[model samples]
Target: MPYTGPQSVDRALEMLDAVADAGGPVSAKALARRLECSLSTAYHLLAPLTERGYLVRTAQGYALGPRIPGLQRSLMQHLEPVPRMADVLAGLRRATGAEAYYTAYRGGLITVVDTTAPVTDTGNPFTPGRETRAHATAHGKALLAELPRPVLRRYLAEHGMPRLTRATITCAEVLEAELSRVRGQGFAVSVGEVDPAYTCLAVALPRGREGGRGRDGGAVHALSVSLPTGEFRRRPQEIRAALAQAAAGCG
Candidate 1:
């Protein structure tokens, strides 16, 4: 080849692979050692991934971000699900006639991995790569449904309850009750908690070969379907069922 590659790029890829293979986040010093480079160089490589939403920082270390699954969701959205999942969401949309989205938990928050809105829809201008409040989102609740009791308790204690709406579950006692129901149902339903006019339903997806949220916050992903409160009121179960199928096909 007339031109060669950037040696820095190659080394950075090596570092990412190492951190991914570790199944959890790694520290800057540890990653530098693995790549036989300086901490500064390792951080430089990590910067792009972080910007691209591929990695997130955790208290213990750096791990994959929630956006990786979003990429997977994009690839699979047009293809078949698992056996190449095709068209279930289309039917779901037609059935409800509103906007829908799929989300997953990452970095102690919910990230919109993928979204689809109706051709005739009138909605907000939010795009992907946005980290939303886990407490106020159905996707977050679904992931929270799987949280160990002690972990959830501690998290609530640390983050404190912030109310986004009158319907938002801000009290610890009330949230505990809601989480209990979510755990039992294996899904979550949020009514005007995130946005006053919108409601969302979510279910946690099983981890793929690579488990955990991106090389950061150590939470699993969930599939979320959101619609206007008016539409959601009419077709809640339909949304939940379709999302369950989508989550199954995520692998």
Candidate 2:
């Protein structure tokens, strides 16, 4: 296919994604093969990234560089929620005995702004980053439920509904029906859609004045709690009450 886009910039970004996905130092040859670019092209791209401190060459291969931390720190700073919201999430975690997350829908994406979990819990999957599968997660669905129909259609068009698990809604029609239920009930639930082992429930907060601007105007915010599937099934009402209280406290 003809490359109509800015090829260099696109390839450079893809290279970075490939490296991050590798989870460790990856060789230039490996990156070239993965990206389906020539060896010389890979080196040409790597040289600039290495010079910019975005990638570092090690004995094993090229790994993420010092600049990555600074970039992540800056992003976190920009996405940082109000101090009170963090407190609310912490309290929700304590009250519900589940992982609590504060999410925002902004810039055509959903982001996990903050999360709180028990001190001993080490297996939590949700993190502070962009959520790609908005169709499959409770927090994402809560925010999506609030979007105007046209906006919702556009979002689905851009980020297609990908199946994360057997329970994930892959069909757009089915997902819209689920979102309708969320709108009616004022909450959303993820029964092992993101991960089979866990269940999550979420409630959207009132629209925010800043960020999250879509065609409709304001940003979307949401709070969610996650627990083991068995535990969630056992105390669904208890967890829902705690989540509601936390959302109210944030207001």
| Model 1 lowest lDDT segment of ten | 77-86
On residues 55-99, what C-alpha lDDT tens digit does candidate 1 reach at each position? 888887888888878877674443222232225445545655655
Residues 159-199, model 2: lDDT tens digits: 99988899999998899999999999989999999899999
lDDT agreement of model 2 with the native: 0.84
Residue 3, model 1, lDDT: 14
TM-score for every candidate vs. truth? 0.55, 0.80
Scored against the true structure, residue 160 in model 1 reaches a CA lDDT of 69
The lDDT of each candidate is: 0.66, 0.84
Best by lDDT: 2
lDDT, residue 210, model 2:
59
- Residue 200 of candidate 2: its Cα lDDT? 92
Model 2 residue 91 lDDT score: 89
